[model samples]
Target: MTALPQERRIVTAIPGPKSQELQARRTAAVAQGVGSVLPVFTARAGGGIIEDVDGNRLIDFGSGIAVTSVGASAEAVVRRAAAQLADFTHTCFMVTPYEGYVEVAEALAELTPGDHAKKSALFNSGAEAVENAVKVARAHTKRQAVVVFDHGYHGRTNLTMALTSKNMPYKHGFGPFAPEVYRVPVAYGYRWPTGPQNAGPEAAAQAIDQITKQVGPDNVAAIIIEPLLGEGGFIEPAKGFLPAIRDFAAANGIVFVADEIQSGFCRTGQWFACEDEGIVPDLITTAKGIAGGLPLAAVTGRAEIMDAAHAGGLGGTYGGNPVACAGALGAIETMRDLDLNARAKAIEVTMKARLTAMAEKFEVIGDVRGRGAMIAIELVKDRTTKEPAPEATAALAKACHQEGLLVLTCGTYGNVLRFLPPLVIGEDLLNEGLDIIEQAFARI
Candidate 1:
């Protein structure tokens, strides 16, 4: 496939005529439950830009929701996947395994945090990896209850929905969810009632106290958390908060799991966000940017814990598909060759400088936080009151869209604007996207 121009160009309106037609067809054929952030139909996407069917090129700040860190069509990933497809599609790893599957597992075992003897089980999505992690924890500990934090988003599956905190879009009316799942307080510095300075230790103490009093530490199977909360407004847990929780889990014999699906893969300047805190989890679940754009996820952890499951107790028919495995190998190679971790750090510096400056001018930007490329701005009515400004957030996003920039809004209250540009995106494109954002804020 030939490369589309890297520059953003608007030949027509935001959705354009062709995209509007496609939107009409999509409405008729697609399920109402599914959602798309933008109505434009993509003809090609790579580097920093997505070209819609109407020939409008828009700077991509979403990166398919952090799944395309190496760019949506990285050359290495495309070549490897194409070669694998030409060779053979699938033979079912469970029935007749392939070397690609084993290789990908080996890569994960080496890359994931902790130097202990680790093993991995590959799956098709982040939710599957999380579900299997829970199963492994339960099997190993022979315990019942699992603990999660406020504003954490695991996935949309039955068990994960129970684990997730948000109710409207993710869990509303979908419940009567899985049992034995408990909720705890996260050390969200911005929203902590006590104040940012005391958020870490106080929240940690409260969570540990609640867990011991309500769930009983001995009965808890696992404690799962995102080192940096993703769907929960990109809230970075206050310093020392994660280590405190890690220590508690260790003392209680509860398995500690890090749901790094969105925060992993060099997006946080480290291989995994948990590394920043030096908190090594027993099991780390990953997916999003694992295989360029193909569907693949893994549960990597201590050998004893991963091996706890009986011979046939784990795996799915399509888990670790060969094509996806090939894509993963290529993606890992690209990350290493390009040193995407450093790139992410550099991007963080650029973003922090710009967003920080913007915060100085715009009081509506109540807070600016996040590490590396996974950054966000929380919108509020007033700096002092800090009342969430969800409508303003939506308007800003729409403004960015109309000006040929694809931005995404997230957060429990839908009052955050997140930027997840591909690590491979050029500096020029990054600055251009930020300029559009500043312009959007001015217009809104």
Candidate 2:
């Protein structure tokens, strides 16, 4: 049965009473460095709603940037984590291996798309998983050059920053990035090098040509990409792009790596977005929703590639924390039982239908595209020109949040409104949120 949202109880202003006080205190105490996305502080979250510090419940559409797929405060996840907590905490998988760690690894090796014998290495964050994948690729291929696609986000670390294409937010101050990292253009259909009509395998072929000419394929170790480019405006590569890239990597002896941090764990209506294209990468890096809300990441790949890393070269002090490992075990089990892949597809269907209708109603909405639960709507000034409407997107997001529906914005130009609702979200709530989006756009 689909559940309707209770109400939109603003209580006070946008920040409310308690949030303002906390914000001032936070400004005084915490590093004035990082900032908050939403001003209202979260006191509790359940199902698809976030209860703020002032007791106002807001419908959640971000899903913690696609990390909490099963929904916040999930009963099954809480129970499993509590049970594991009672037993013990840490043993350091490097020094003394635990059954839970191995169990999680086994689950990953089995669940990750591929029929081949695979191995998994655990880490604590998406960045770590990406870094380790690079190490493994270098070790296996005995090459130093690694190629990454434009608009792909790996992580914030030095190596990842170099691998990442964004500049202002991620790699602004951090200079002198890691060496031997290369970047190529991704097949962005909306505004491709050649017009959208010609943005198919031909765009990818041009990129491959540039790499072969400039970088020289003989020196490349690996080519990394997100199956569905996440931070790069949720752009889905053209039909033939992925397959062509895969074939090129295989033919050139360059290990193909899939950065599934954002698109993994059924976020794309499949275990990994790569599965949709039937391209099994040599290495797949995952994190985000892998361990429910806990911090955990992994690199699962061909046994030969994974085994190339030296025994001690791939571990962190708290790499596979026991609690996190237990969380991952429970999360994977929950995904299997709940059939989250199907749920993602269901969410995609709901979103595509309503958003497409909304697009027809609004000229600001230029494009609507995504794989599954991971979806985004690109805002533009005009349908003919496709000029990004960043201000309009900001206005729409602000209006939705004021109306008690939380949505996130992304893109190089900041004109895209992305929806990453929990797969377990109720249909009524989802529709209600879509209604709010419609109302916001109507006001525009």
Which residue runs does candidate 2 get wrong by more than 4 Å? 1-9
Pairs of colliding residues, candidate 1: none
List the RMSD of every prediction in angstroms: 1.0, 1.8
lDDT of 1 at 77: 95
Evaluate residue 129 in candidate 2 and report its C-alpha lDDT on the 0 to 100 scale.
93
| Candidate 2 residue-wise lDDT at 21 | 91
Model 2 lDDT vs. the true structure? 0.87
* lDDT (tens digit, per residue) of candidate 1 on 19-77: 99999999999999999999999999999889999999999999999999999899899
Cα deviation of 5, candidate 2, in Å: 8.4
Best by TM-score: 1
Quote the lDDT for 115 in model 1: 91
In candidate 2, what are the lDDT values of residues 1-444, reduced to their tens digit? Answer: 123244455676777889889988898899865766678998887667877999888888998989989776666667777887888777788899888889988888888888898999999999999999999999998989999887888899999999999896889988999999988888899888567777767778887998899899989998999989888789898878988999999999999999999999999999999998798999999999988898899999999889998889889888888888888877787788889999999999999999999989888889999988999999999888889998998999999988888999888888999999988888888899999999999997
* Cα TM-score of candidate 1: 0.99
